[model samples]
Target chain A: MPKPERIDPTDARLLLALTEHPRATTVALAEQSGLSRNTVQARLASLDGGAKLRSFERRVDPTALGYPLTAFVTTQVTQRRLDQVAEALAAVPEVLQVHGLSGETDLLVHVVATDADDLYRVAGQILGIPGVERTNTALVMRQLVDYRLTPLLRRAAEQ
Target chain B: MPKPERIDPTDARLLLALTEHPRATTVALAEQSGLSRNTVQARLASLDGGAKLRSFERRVDPTALGYPLTAFVTTQVTQRRLDQVAEALAAVPEVLQVHGLSGETDLLVHVVATDADDLYRVAGQILGIPGVERTNTALVMRQLVDYRLTPLLRRAAEQ
Candidate 1:
């Protein structure tokens, strides 16, 4: 295990800049955070070691790509095979997101299929994973707006 | 407005392959799809004209980067400011996934914040948006997995 490196306010600020535009150059990030360029690089290196950094890559709309079926499936698992089930679910291509959620369900899965028929087949595959007892699935009717990370990064900077 | 371009099964197969590995060269894709490289490049040209190929980009993870606060905010809108509320809320940087939901709430927003306090600040900002009636939020504790196109594309290819 790596030692926990402390993150100062300036390092956090620099991270905010990069989160918004992962493509932001070292010089641009330094200017944005009012830090020296080398300082920004060193801080980024520290960030890499301490906390994971998710980069800014273009996120596409599934519907736009002809995947009209989307569902949020929540599952409850039997204790014994939690990790195995979760790992197996992760390997499935349609299940975009899997999580150990807190509410009524222990696991939450976000999935995409070409149509209702395909969704059923994919859901069956998920259900087959060991330890999965029950699943509640909600179909996405239509997408209003999708993903944009700009606001998230901005709020963190303000903090 | 972009008119829809027709995509045959072969075209769909090629597109799905590209979505799976955007960096895959046409030659490699040809080997995977069992099609000539020239056929693949021509399909790319037609899709570009129709705006079917939005972009090819690397997908980045946000949590790995330190902005770990992720939430889904469902908001109800006053009749007068439905459009304005949606637009304003969309303007916020933290709210990455915004949806005009149907049932109890008018919209559902996915936000990524730096931490717990940061998520609160983002929620507050959403509450401040004009015509915003009220908001309920579900924070994402873990992102087990995320955006990938291969699975969906594979189904399209089969069709």
Candidate 2:
């Protein structure tokens, strides 16, 4: 993870406006933030250039699309095969998000499968991967929230 | 809860492409799709208008930035307090996402806090809110994979 880029008050204001509405044009962003369109445009370009801002995106429902199985898989890798295990796990297309973590779980994996049968296939397949110590899985009974960069960006904007 | 808005293969393809690279111009989409840029643009316009392609955004990490604690708070509200509960939960600035889900959990909530202490305090504070029943939380230790929208969108473009 890289360091969070420094931002100004105006950048903060821009972030807030965008989190609620990511696609607001310069004109709209400026109008909402009380800045001129040009200024907003310039700042947007600069912020993006500075890596403080990235692209915008929409939120979609994965389940609605027939991917009914979602789970968070925590892995405890053997001391010898940790790196290899992470690499193999990261290779899967079905795995949505992977992160290295602390505590009993060295890595956490989130995967989406078409159904329980699909999930079973994935688990069976992954269990055979080299160096995997153990796995704990939590099937999502429901997805309260999936992913959105906006909220954190908005919070950063607030600061 | 609403119908999974009748979406088709072409629409899904378009979404997958845009979700992968929202900045990809209509010309590229046209080239990739063997369609006209004007047509691609037009379809995108309709999707945008319909709130299908609301906005594009990148999902970042809160833990990487020092907010290490993450939890999913499962909430249930009586019929009478449904609206009240939803509204109150949404008001909590720390609440990143609030959603209605299936199975035993009626609602799912995602929250980010600086640490366990912060998470505890925030969860307790939220419980203090009227109509919030006992909350169950599972702290995330790590992320193994993020099946983000972008990659799926990219695959759609390739097809």
Candidate 3:
């Protein structure tokens, strides 16, 4: 990962405001942040131009698309074919996120399925990948806490 | 969890188009999906009204906000105090997402930290939670694939 750019407290405040209202216009953001309209626009431009911002696709939920079952698959793979394994996993639509980790498990794969049978098929598809050796699937029974960043943003702004 | 509403191919097409261009105007989505503008607007309204859509906050990357290290902490907690444990975990800004899983580990916690020491602190905080029994941390060395939904959206459209 590239060196993360440190966001100032002012930036944090703006981000927090934006988090509250994602569709907030520049004028509204300026009003919320107590900054000039030009300042808001310029800061937003910088944030957008930098690596700080990401695409809005993550807002869409897999469950809404009919694949409600969520599972984490810890995978062991052949070291030599690691790249190929990732490539193959990418081709599987059920596979949502893959993270290489430091530990016994080589990769952590996030997948979603429509049902138990679909999950089985998705897991099988992953294991059949060229370098994938083994996988342990743990189905998510409930979401104790949904994905969130507001608290962190609050912390950042406080800092 | 509520019963997931199934999306038809037309809805999938519109969603897939939205996934590609999150800020696409209603007319643009209609053109992209070869559907009437009114139809696109109605479908989007329905999708937004239902439990299908999620907040856009997931688009904000933790790394960009000065927390570069990412780790998944599998936590075992007192079954009876699961709700309290989740509430305590939410109070800690570093704890991003937590899921109750069907496995030996009761909860999977996603967290971010500024560095190794910060990670240790975050882990310790989680372990200190009233009901949190044991926690295992797995540091993400690399992101093989980031969170995505376009492929799944395409599959839904094709279905």
Most DockQ-accurate candidate: 3
Q: Provide all candidates' interface root-mean-square deviations.
A: 5.4, 4.9, 1.8
Point to the candidate with the largest lDDT.
3
**TM-score of chain A, predicted model 1, versus the true chain A, to 2 decimals:** 0.72
Chain A TM per candidate, in order of listing: 0.72, 0.77, 0.92
* A1-159: candidate 1 lDDT, tens digit per residue: 663343445755775665455446678989988999899878877665454332211333455566667787768888677778878887898887776654534776888887889999988998888778988676665455555544444444565
Alpha carbon RMSD to native, model 1: 6.5
Q: Candidate 3's fnat?
A: 0.84
lDDT per residue for candidate 3 within B56-120, as digits (tens), equals: 56877788888999999999988889899989988888988999999644899999999999999
Question: Which runs of model 2 end up more than 4 angstroms from their true locations?
Answer: A1-3, A19-21, A53-61, A64-66, A104-106, A144-159, B1-21, B24-34, B49-91, B98-109, B114-120, B123-147, B154-159
Over 4 Å off in model 3, which ranges? A1-4, B1-4
By summed lDDT, the worst window of 10 consecutive residues in model 3 chain B runs over: B48-57
- Rank ordering of all candidates by TM-score, starting from the highest: 3, 2, 1
Identify the superior model by DockQ, candidate 1 or candidate 2.
Answer: 2
lDDT of 2 by residue, A71-150 (tens): 76666777676667767876776677666655544666767788889888887667778777688666766333434545
| Candidate DockQ scores, in order | 0.26, 0.31, 0.69
lDDT value, residue B96 of candidate 3: 89
TM-score of 1: 0.64
Best by TM-score: 3
Q: How accurately is candidate 1 docked according to DockQ?
A: 0.26
Question: Across residues B1-159, which tens digit of lDDT does each residue of candidate 1 receive?
Answer: 554554556877876666555446668889888899899778766765564553221233356435556677767888666667767876776666665544534666767777889888989999998888888777666555654555655665687
